[model samples]
Target: MPTYPLLAPPPLSSGSPSAHPPSIVTSLVPPMFNAQAEESPKNLILKKVMNELDRINNGMNKSITLNSPTINDLEDCCVKSALNCFQSKVLYLSVPDGKLKKLQIIISNELHKIVNRVSDCKPKELEKAQCKPCDSYKEVDSQTFVQNLKTLLQKIYASQP
Candidate 1:
């Protein structure tokens, strides 16, 4: 009988340092939102929006980890596509543009709308995913984090304005 060669497992974390030939994935800085910090109410609203968006985004990350295909699967697709970099496919949807600043505001606003629609998930649904149940009374820091991010993003936008 002939023995098959053993295969190495994919990196457990995204962008691990051990990835040979260091991936060419460039670091991206999300564009700033507004020109003046004190002049815009957009910061506050955007902050509120980002808070909600972060929750859903983070939940999606957790869901993928719990139920979706792993990086190994993506690697197979990359090989089939003849793509050299896995990072490239991960970011293909985010082709950066000079107008990213404006686009972000619109996106953030839309995200806020979506977040509003889905902020509360049924307890049973969360349980089905093996996630901790949400507490109606417990404090969530997402609001503050989102607010800070928005302020920072606003500053970035202001620079372009």
Candidate 2:
């Protein structure tokens, strides 16, 4: 059998350098992480991305669309796009991270609370807001339709194995 310490995990000859440390480093190396630091291009790239996102989020002007003649009448398109982006970007429970489950549970419970709040409302309340009950009713029916389609797709995927 091969020895440890001086071996250095075969020098990572693979193209992607799949890490395969032979012996545990915790037993050998000192507890200082700063001494083992390497150049992390990913950290630099992530910092740049975060800076760009911050700039975009803070600098975006809604008045650009508001003042434009073409989009002035097409405000509904902008609203729909914003709502679609929100829905699409929601990190669902199916994500690999455990924290997403907490967020999912919180969001699910909050939506339930919102629905419960509105469930006992009078017809006049909806009418005053110019909101029809049928507006969200259609969305609910469509959501169910899409969910059923997704279940069918899951079944097909399972059958492939």
Candidate 3:
């Protein structure tokens, strides 16, 4: 009687099974590849806002380091630059009416505080011949402002359809 030949399994070296050769079926199939989807308009806007905030933060740090002689000078330089950067970015962004109103209020409040602090630190001349003690510079809490902006951005992004 004639017998048919049988295929043998791959040899195993020690007790562990040997690695199997690449299968033609798997090779023919496409690799587990996924294309990255494009970001939504809201996401893009949020990213731009975050980037602008970063730029403002960096500018503040640079101004602080360079104008360290007087606390007033440091505060003036840093605050002015930060406000300018923020204002420019705000103007550039075209937020929806609902979010725009909220953003405007928050930004206005923060700016008011900054402006008041700056005014308070300004040197005033006395009418009399006597010199007066200068008011100490009040540090602006930008971290809180930035955090609030980030929270607002998150809300805006979430609310987007």
Candidate numbers sorted by lDDT from highest down: 3, 1, 2
**How do the residues 1-161 of candidate 3 rate in per-residue lDDT, one tens digit apiece?**
33322333353355344454433465557897568677764466565665555555433322121101122233322433334334433333333455454554454445434333332223332222232122322323444445444554454456446
Every model's Cα RMSD, please?
Answer: 25.9, 20.6, 16.6
Which residue runs does candidate 2 get wrong by more than 4 Å?
1-96, 118-121, 132-161
Tens digits of per-residue lDDT, candidate 1, 1-161, equal 43423333345446574763434334344666788566344444445445544543343222111111222223221221211121112222231343543443554455444333323445565444442222211332433333333443344334332
lDDT tens digits by residue: candidate 2, 35-86:
6566344333323333433333332322221111111222222322222222
TM-score of each: 0.22, 0.21, 0.32
lDDT of each: 0.35, 0.33, 0.41
The alpha-carbon root-mean-square deviation between model 2 and the true structure, to one decimal in Å, is 20.6
Best by lDDT: 3
Superposed by TM-score, candidate 1 places the C-alpha of residue 105 at a distance from the truth, in angstroms, of 2.8
Model 3 weakest lDDT span, ten residues long: 62-71
Model 1, position 36: C-alpha lDDT score:
50
TM-score between candidate 2 and the true structure: 0.21
- Looking at candidate 1, the ten consecutive residues that score lowest on lDDT are 80-89
Task: For candidate 2, list the clashing residue pairs, or say none.
Answer: none
